[model samples]
Each structure stands twice: as C-alpha cells, then as structure tokens.
Target: IMAVPGPSLFTLRDTSQKVVRYHHNRLVASPQTANAPPGGLQISVVPNQFMDPSHFPIIMGINGGTRCLSCGTSAQPTLMLEVSTHHWGVRPRAF
Candidate 1:
C-alpha cells in the first residue's frame, strides 16, 4: 500500500532511471527507509480518496497475523487497498 507518484510506479528503472520492465499490478523493490524489513510483493491499486490513511500498506505475516506499514508523509499520490484475501474471501497474511 505504498504510495508512488503516478502510473509509472511499476516501471522498473535502472540506475539511470531508464525503464527496465513494466510490471502491471505488481512490483519488487527495496524500501526507501531503514525502519522497514526487506522483501514483499508490491501490487498497484487504483487511487481511492475515501480510504483511511491508517489502513494503508496492510502487512501480514506467514503465521497469519496482520499488521500495517507506514511509509511516512509523501506529496505523491497513493493507492488504497481494499483487501488482500484468499479465494475463500478471507484476508491473508505473510511472514
């Protein structure tokens, strides 16, 4: 649920900022801050102004626990997460 600047969020860029690969709906990147743990899938979402800020970036553990990740303040627009659930309609978690 991290917020990125625009539709170019998943456009994998090289060190020179050249487009490496465009990943539709998903991305893999390291966090910009040191407080966060590494490695997780980053899926794109449509912008939703009605969403609660606290609900952004919902984090889950492999043990099935749920949590949240805060990416700090950003002037860039962000996407809202409706839910990350299983086919059975239950939300999922990760380790």
Candidate 2:
C-alpha cells in the first residue's frame, strides 16, 4: 500500500448531489494483480474517517508500464495516490 499527503477534507458530491466529507489528510492506494484476465491490475484506495490514523504509512505507489505485444510500444505509466489516515497538520492556509 502507498500513502501520500492529501487534503484535510475531501469533499465530493454523490449521485444524489449531497456532499460527502472524508476526514483524512492522506490518501492510500494498493495495487493487486488481477488473475482472472491475464495482465489485468486492480488498484484500491483507502483512508476514510473511520480508519485508525496511527497504523497507516505515508508513501505513494506508481505503476510502471504495459508494453504492447505486437508493436513493442509501452503504455504510459500511472501514479496512484493513496493517503494516510494520520493528519500531518501541515495544510496550507488560505491566502
């Protein structure tokens, strides 16, 4: 699992237009190889308000690349953002 610093309150609108707030200052993502469809990968994000802050780590995970079988070209790699449950108390103040 990879964790990175994130916003204090991640507010997003749900399908019903209600704003959802997550009390987390970090994001965490974990990538697992999908075996059902060969060469498939699945990434999961964690760190909600309910999670304990002390156990989470602060790091980030990035996917390398996927090469095309025929053309020998590689697909662009993606960096996943996984936040930690712990609050760093280093948020930027409004200017």
Candidate 3:
C-alpha cells in the first residue's frame, strides 16, 4: 500500500491570543477504491469545544487519489471553511 499523508491538527485563537478551540481532524478512506464512481475520501473535523451540536463534528467530501500531473506524489489535502454569525456567541449553544 502507498503511504498517504494523513490530516493534521489545528487550533483557533481569539483576538486576545487565547486558544478558544481546537480541531481533531482526520481523513477517512472508504472501503472502495479511490477511482470509484464517486470520490471515496472524507474529512472530519471534531472541535474540542464551543461548537454547535449540529456542527460539532463537521464532515466533508474530498477528491481522493495519489496520482499527480507533474509531481510524482501529490499528498496535499484541502479544507474549506464557511463562517457565519451563528457559529459564534458569548456562550456555547446547543442544538
């Protein structure tokens, strides 16, 4: 099996330079092959705290594979974020 680069851990800090939360991130490979009908890669981000229940563990799709056009091994991953007012508050909120 090829050695794929896994996910990395990240944190978020407030204006005061205080770490407000952290992300326990991971990449899950599906049972099927990467070149299947649809992409079999998924990215999950579980926050340490101050997350809405509905969005606590955020899961998103990823284009899976190890092949590259110019480079031999393209092992980089991408993450997209969509921030909104509902994601922040004076206190943590529940779903």
| Winner of 2 and 3 under lDDT | 3
CA lDDT for candidate 3: 0.32
lDDT of 1 by residue, 3-55 (tens): 55642122233464433221353333443345543333332333332334564
Q: Please estimate how well model 1 matches the true structure, expressed as its whole-model Cα lDDT.
A: 0.35
TM-score of each: 0.21, 0.18, 0.21
- Cα lDDT of model 2 by residue, 10-51, tens digit: 223345544322125322222223532232222223343323
By TM-score, the candidates rank as 3, 1, 2
Q: Model 3, 87: alpha-carbon shift in Å?
A: 6.9
- Off-target runs (Cα >4 Å) in candidate 3 are 1-39, 51-88
Error of 1 at 87 (Å): 2.4
As for TM-score, the candidate ahead, 1 or 2, is 1
lDDT of each: 0.35, 0.29, 0.32
Highest lDDT against the true fold, candidate:
1
Lowest summed lDDT over 10 consecutive residues: which window, candidate 1?
59-68
lDDT order of candidates, best first? 1, 3, 2
Given candidate 2, what's the lDDT at residue 35? 30
